[model samples]
Target: MAKTFASQGDLAEKHTSFTEVGDGVYAFTAEGDPNSGVIIGDESVMVIEAQATPRLARKVIDCVRSVTDKPISHLVLTHYHAVRVLGASAYGAPQVIMSDAARAMVVERGQEDWDSEFGRFPRLFQGHEEIPGLTWPTTTFSDSMTVYLGKRRVDIMQLGRAHTAGDAVVWLPDAEVMFTGDIVEYHSACYCGDGHFADWAGTLANIAGFEPVAIAPGRGDALLGRARVAEAIANTADFVESTYRPVAKVAARGGSLKEAWDSARAVCDPKFGAYAIYEHCLPFNIARAYDEARGIDTPRIWTAERDREMWAALQG
Candidate 1:
């Protein structure tokens, strides 16, 4: 029998933890699941990456309330993925921010992505009925923007495309801490269904340039200290390269998609099989890598139909 699609069968709930990575910077992580970051400035709060549903987001809000009563003034989206942005309404933030490219993607493929993802990961969309359509950004920037809460500065930047064409990161210069949305993952599978493999490495280099003392990655435990941060970056890079390189090689030889998928698994499974969501992301990641290797620069939109078709072709 064919394996379940994505995390559809993952019904068990994970244990969530809220950790203070820096002075007022926080990370809310749920074992291998998606994570949210919080930056409490002098007066207001900024949340990075909303959870999949309003109910899930409320948990993050509760975490924020536990730390401070500051009103959340800004909600920053690292990319345009349903799992990351659908819960924005729960925050009631005045400004919802995202990169220009991400905004365009939402306009283009948001609904399709929402449907496709909902079907793939039913557990993540706990309160699916409560999500009011798509989550639209109130503000968009081309490359970078800065938000000031009193004297504290939070630099939001689109360093380069990696996980998605519009991937962005939040940087705290003074505290030397960074909130890297799926741009970097520690001991978690790097979902590359819409990723740019080669460019992602360069983007990681740019993130390293900041020399952040600590990092709140999109998933997994937060990395503290420079050494741990560097290790996380390296692990992320390795996962991307291990998956992309073998698939690219197979495609270069005019191999079939299944051949490419097999090649990627042989190389990546031994190294990353134990990572969270590794099984769920493998087929999608391999498909994207194969397309990119064949000179398809733009990632094809993944509709519900396409998702099922790909799963049947690869995993079935």
Candidate 2:
């Protein structure tokens, strides 16, 4: 029989744990899956990154229920990815926040992304019927916005584009913890399907200024201490560097995207072999890296049809 996905036979569903990173800061992680961060303020709460579906998002709510009774007022999307934003309706956080660029991306390519991603990873969206529609952010900012969770300060800064053109980080200066959305994937592979390589590196440097002692990355274990935090950033940077350099080098030499893919595969296939979705991501990674190397700052929309065409053109 073919292997199954999403449903982990190891652990029954509805097992969400709220891990306290600091006094009021918590991370809601499901059995080794994508993580969501919660910041409890003087009154209300702020949630970062909605899961795949409303039903899946409720799992985070169940985790939050274990901690406190504060009502969640804001839902912040780190980027415009379908897996991260589709579950917004579950929270009903009043204000769904994202970068202006992210909102624009949703307008431009969200439907295509929905189809493409749902096709790519069926397990993530286990309860697909629960998804009402494409998630839209009612409140958006071009660069930054500071939300007062009663009295606590949460700074939303869009330093530079990395994972996506509108990628942003949730930073708590006093606590010195930042929720880097897919910017620092620990165990999972960085999905460079719509990434900007050079800008991503610059974004990493920009994040360094805050010097977050604890970081809740888009995936993997939340870093509870400083050293592990730095390790996460360094590891992310190394992966980004390794993936892009070969692609750029090949593209600069007038080689085709196919050649770039092969060269990048030679380097990444062995090193990043263990990371989840490494194979599924390589073709898109090579495509984006090649485009950036050729001076394309903004990545093009990735429709489901375009997905297969690109895959076949580059690898098939």
Candidate 3:
């Protein structure tokens, strides 16, 4: 049987887990759905990466309320993906923060992304109608910014282009906990549709420099120790290298996109095939890798129409 395009046929529900990785830091993860991190400060709370919809976000909010009643004062978007940002309205945060690059992406392709992603993963957008439109950042920074939840200091830093042009990681310096938004996926497929394959590896190195004691990755279970953290980071890097390197080699030889995809899959599927979203992300990841290998620096915006055309060409 032919494979489904993206996640169009995926309908099984995933169990959600809310784990407290640090003193006041929490990770909200669904099987392979987008994850969110919560940091409770002395006076308020900062949430990283809102889920796809307000209805989905409420589960995180409920988890937050169960632990602490602190007001959610800030919402941090690690990048400009619709599944990660469209739930901003539910937080009622005065400050919605992201890197300047992310803000620019929101302006450039936010709507297109919203439409594209929703079409790809309808389960994630259960309450799509409730979305109040694009989630805009009230505050944008160039490189880094810091927020104080009383005495607690959470540093938001953009190490380099990885998952996206504006990828950011939330670091709690004192607590030694890092919320690495899709920059370091553990046991999950790295979606390279909007990724920078080369830069992403370097960004992972930067993340390693922090030597976090605990890591709240964008997906999978939280990494609780330095060893696990190291493993997750290395696994993410390996996945990227394994996928992009093969595809790049094929593209350099003037191979067709399908040829590039097959090369990448041959190398990746043996190892990463069972990983969450591996199949869903393969086509798009290969498409982006093909473009990058052929010298396309900026990733083209993926509208719903573009998604269908690409899926048809690749999967048919």
Candidate 4:
């Protein structure tokens, strides 16, 4: 029998930890599951990355309530992904923000992505029934935008494309803290299905240039202090490079998708085989990397059918 999707078998609950990496700034992480960040401003709060469903989002809300009573004024999504944005309704923030490219993606392939992701990872969408619909951004910026909650200033900028075409990172300059969504993962695998492999490294470099004192990564534990922050960034860069280099070489030589998969496994398995979601993400990551290697700039829209077809090709 064919193997099941790694995530479908991952029904076990992860112990969620709410850690305060910076003063008034918190990270809500559930083992290797999706993570959310809270930036408490003077009078209100800004949340980064909503969970997959209302039920899961409520867990983050509970963590937020545990710290402060400030109402969420803005819901900032780092990228346009079902796992990151579907639970947005639960936040009830007046201003839902995204980069212009990210908003365009929502208009283009949001629904398809939702259908595809829901089929891949059922455990993340615990309260699928409660999801209102596709999440839309009420506010969007082209390059960068700064929002002020009373006296506190939060800068949201798209430094470069990495995990997605319109990936954004939240920088708290005063606190020297950063909330990076999927751009940097400590021990977890970087989901590169919608990634830009060539540009990912430059994006990581842009993030490192800021020299953040603390970083709330997209997955894994929060990185506190400059040393840990640097370590995660370097590790993420290595992961991105390690996956792309071998696959690109195979594609560059006109190898088939299966060839690319074998090549990637030979390199990524030993280093990242034990990472969270490694198996689930490998097929998609290899598919995208193969396309990128062949000069496919824009990632093809992934529908549920396409996901399974690719999985069977790689896993069969």
Q: How close is every model to the real structure, measured as TM-score?
A: 0.98, 0.92, 0.98, 0.98
lDDT of 2 at 264: 89
Residue-level lDDT of model 3, residues 86-182, one tens digit each, is 9888988659999999999999999999999999999999988999899999999999988988999989999999889999999999889999999
Query: Candidate 1's residue-wise lDDT over 269-313, tens digit each?
Result: 889999999999999999999999999888999999999999999
Clash statistics: count for each candidate = 0, 0, 0, 0
lDDT of each: 0.93, 0.83, 0.92, 0.93
Indicate the TM-score of model 4. 0.98
For model 3, what is the error of residue 304's alpha carbon versus the real structure, in angstroms, after optimal superposition? Answer: 1.0
lDDT (Cα, tens digit) per residue for candidate 2, span 1-316? 1022212222344345677888789887654467899999888888999998998898888877788898999999999899899988999746889999999999999998998887666767788998989999989998999999877899998989889988999998779999998888876778887998887888988887778888888877788888888888888888898999998999888998888988988888787877755666677788889999999888988877887787668654
Superposed model 4: Cα runs more than 4 Å off: none
For residue 50, what is the lDDT in candidate 4? 87
* Per-residue lDDT over 1-316 for candidate 4, one digit per residue giving the tens place of the 0 to 100 score: 2279647888888999999988899999988998999999999999999889989989999999998998999999999999999999998756999999999999999999999999999999888999999999999999999999888899999999999999999999888999999999989999999999999999999999999999999999999999999999999998999999999999988889999999889999999999998998889999999999999999999999999899888898
Model 2's number of clashes is 0
Worst 10 residues of 1 by lDDT: 1-10
Q: What is the lDDT of residue 278 in candidate 3?
A: 88
Clashing pairs in 4: none
- Output the TM-score of candidate 2: 0.92
